[model samples]
Target: MNPRALRAAGPAILIVAAALTTIAALAYGGAADPLATGDPGPFVRWGLPMAKLLVNVSAAVMAGSLVLALFALKAGDREFDGALDVSSIGAAVFTVASGAVGFLTFLDSFNPELSAGPEFGAQLGRFLTEVELGRTWLMTMIAAAVVTILTFAVRSWTATLLTAILALVSLIPMATQGHSGELASHDATVTALSLHVVGAAVWLGGLVLLVVLRPVLDARRVPDVLRRYSSIALVAFVVVALSGFARTLSAISAWEQLATPYGGILCLKVAALVLMGLLGAWYRRLLIGRIDSANAARAAKAGRAFWTLIAVELAFMGIASGAAAALARTPPPATETPYSSTPAEVLTDEPLPPELTFDRWFTTWDVDLLWAFVAAAGIVFYLAGVIRMRRRGDRWPVYRTVLWVLGMLTLFWVTSGPVNAYQDYLFSLHMLGHMLLTMGIPLLLVPGAPITLALRAIEKRDDGTRGGREWIMWAVHSPFARVVTHPLVAAGIFVGSLWVFYFTDLFRWSLYDHLGHVWMVTHFLISGFLFVMSLTGIDPLPYRMPYPGRLVTLIAVMAMHAFFGVAMMMQSGLMVAEWFGAMGRTWGPTPMEDQYIGGGVAWSIGEIPTLITAIVVAVQWSRSDERQQRRSDRHADRTDDAELEAYNARLARIAERDEAADKAAR
Candidate 1:
């Protein structure tokens, strides 16, 4: 097909191609058939997959259009409007598809007779409330409907961002649908699947948006937009690959199991991904340059080449998406080994890691894919900023760069290493991770001065598009930042969280729920960063006390922090003894003793960072005094000591007046 024709037909081609491919794969996988007993018939089995296929495609369209719109297009422009329009339509489709799938699933799960009677309505209502699957889809449909309205009604940057976030949130329910199976790594499975879905959406939807907007984009703007889209696609490619690997690992036990039908489908998806990666490499290496720099005749040639490449990539994406749907339906190769597992395996989806030892801190590893991504991204962006500054003949401090790198690595180690391995069972390990995350990591990180670096490095966007720099600027100045970064508020959170967490069920929740653990980590880290930043950070904050005031703030906070540790040490009853004590560890100390060790670490080692903070604050205070003195001297030099001279003259006049009064009296 000609480029124009291909551009018009891209979405249709992807949908139809993916639908047919998914149907074929499902048939081959035998997911199109119901069980032999109490069969719900072919309709439920067949229709469910089709509805799922539709949901995936529409979700991609919704998320992709908004992501590109936020990243590349200018507000109040035709392209921006067109992007929003696509998002709205996609969300509407997603809503309808979600409802259809929910209904089909109700039929498949409960095998209720289709009826127009009130009884059927009551049955559906009960299913929506009573069953997890039914509730998941119901919530998904509701979220989609809301997204549809928001995308259609709002086109501003902030609105677009919120809408995109809601669209992403809508996918969370779908994570509960798949079979986590015998190992039951529900958290990992959900996380991996969610990342895969969002990444694929960005990967596929951005290209589709570009194709859809072809008629409106001139060569000048097209290359710029294409480059932006390429940047997003690159990130998406990495995320999808890593998340896919994680998801795959959880599915089967061994590499040899790839011979299974399910594994064969997975291989098909992987091959498609490999081909897409190669195409992306080709685009970056050759076509982007050609398309951006070519003349009229050559430009036409480049456009044709780029569009053809895009079309071919979309076809491969279709295969991957289709294969994914099929793979979801098929059962994986057996993973249940003969060796029995502890309760931890059933609770957390993996066996408890090996016994904790001092050597294991450096030797053992259990990477949280999400935080690994965060650490990697943090290092990558910081280095990129420093490089940009250096290339522009501006200097960023070498120490700041070193500190930033150290901070990121430390964060990775604490979150994904042996500390994380034993945190759930051992109180001492948990405290070690907490101390590092809350105090040690932030001390190093705050000195890195990321916000200051970002402000210096990222170019400002003036096209009414909220790019990285603009968003960062907005966030830094946002009301939320003002509140959280307030010295008093930060101090409150830093100290108060300790009592609230251990005393309440929040600590237990963090142990039991993956998301709660994430929240706990995030809250502590931010609270720590804010507190440190308030005292001595080089970065700009909304509000900071004078140097002496900062010193006082630091002193008060340190006392509370130390006291919290001391209180932990003094606790007669165990904290969360039911969970930590009941872990049945054979190697570690008794839970109560471990809690004592944890308290000691909290009191002594935690104070080490607090002492460091005090020293830094004192140094800053001394330097602040010197700076004020220098300013005073500069004022004297500027005004030639007029104030001092005036004061001396007033004293002389008073003396003369007193002498005259004395002479008159004589």
Candidate 2:
């Protein structure tokens, strides 16, 4: 390895040392034995955490290198290829480390008998196939192995992106683990942990990649590359900070818990994270502008300063990463959520929320961290884009901004408020959320024209870098996107998903699995957006039907929706009867009665958006006609009624010819 690589290795060294020391200290000194009666030896105890720490570092390198190569590094350059090489090696290490951790975890959790016999094989088979944790590890291992091979063989941007996705997937199983036993915070904890891992991987991995590429990069390109990376780092910082905060809130409910060893480790992690954030801010403020400048002197000075800054930032990031591993080993004050005895609470992570009065709709809150983050990010990015436009003296309509903000707020409320809380128990509230998600929310968002604003605000890259605009354009124009955004397909999905979801096993899947829930909401919002945008979107579409066609589609869709709602109301059979019926609740409507009310909501409240849509389509149709007429008037002005004159002249010739024929005959 180059001396430059040694410099890069410092952060990894610090992270490993810190994690090993912290975990070992916990094993020897603090708290009760995590192991059961007649525990496994110290090697198993220390080995598990050590393996986990290795997995984390390797994951960062694998994911970060791919991300950096995709976002910043130019193709076929030494820096880009080196990043890919690093990703390949990292993924290889990641595979071995993850498999080790899996083996260690199985031993830790089950205390299975040590043997190389048929009995051991049978137990191992059962473990891998039957248990959720085991299955997760098996999936992770498979994904990591795939990433290792792909990263080595493939160097294209698209292939690298796929490899990066697989690397991210490998972490998902790990994140979902250790969160399930905790009930009230189960879903949130899982989501938070998942985001934390991804964010940390990107941040930590990018920094490592930068260090690794120090010798390969040209001095002049350094500023531009770092500038590109800064925005990515900024987003990663927000994700890590928010997710860490969420995990903290879930773990420590009372002030006294902060006094414990677990809290101390958590605090250490937070402090390191906060310090790193400040360092990042300093880099953004002081170093980036100086670096991106074309002046040779300024660029040279900024380059040296940036290297130093990155080295220090990596150290701090290491501290956080290490403390994270240690924190995993440390036991929290609360694990199994308090009083998950009630069926409603056990199933939904909380008791059935208050009934859907007008008051409760605005009052109650049960946040889904994933959607909350999405909403917050959406609002912030939209406002930032609008602000950037204004700063550039470009005018964006106030109505568009207002509509975007309202749409984001509506999304936030529906996902993070009472609607989420009661949606599981009450079919009526679930229908309400569906209408808001699919109809009401899209109504606001489509008018906002977010895509147009983003395309305008984000700087265009001519250097063939795969930036945000490129990605967006690719999505819009790709074959899959083209098909999905087709007017007929969009309308079909919007209506068909509802029937297919409710009638099939998908609804139950959504209820039982958090990821399924995510899919349900995500699909609803996307399909709704596609359908609504097909009609009234100000942004460019691949192919927009004429206003008349749009109006016809709108009417047909509304008629179909009305029919669906009516059908829902007339149906006597329960949807997901087993899941909903079993949730023990003393209050509100019975499952059957609740299903009836849900149908009523679907039939009645669903039409309000349809009515609104019909009105909008009519207005659009009228304006389209007016625009056509204006175009005709302009044509008349330009030509001075030439076509009309030609038609009259033709008629006059025909009459003269006829008169001549009559005279000749006489």
Poorest lDDT segment (10 consecutive residues) of candidate 2 = 177-186
Against the true structure, what is each candidate's TM-score? Answer: 0.92, 0.94
- Report backbone clashes per prediction: 0, 0
Over 339-430, each residue of candidate 1 has an lDDT whose tens digit, in order, gives 54776665556677778777987898877877888899999999999999999999988999999899999999998888887788788989
Q: In model 2, what is the error at residue 595, expressed in angstroms?
A: 0.6
User: What TM-score does structure 2 among the candidates reach?
Assistant: 0.94
Error of 2 at 41 (Å): 1.4
Measured with C-alpha atoms, the lDDT of residue 48 in candidate 1 is 76
lDDT by residue (329-380, candidate 2, tens digit) is 6668766655677777777776566556778877889898889999888999
In candidate 2, position 335 carries an lDDT of: 66
Q: Give the TM-score comparing model 1 with the true structure, all chains together.
A: 0.92
Model 2 backbone overlap count: 0
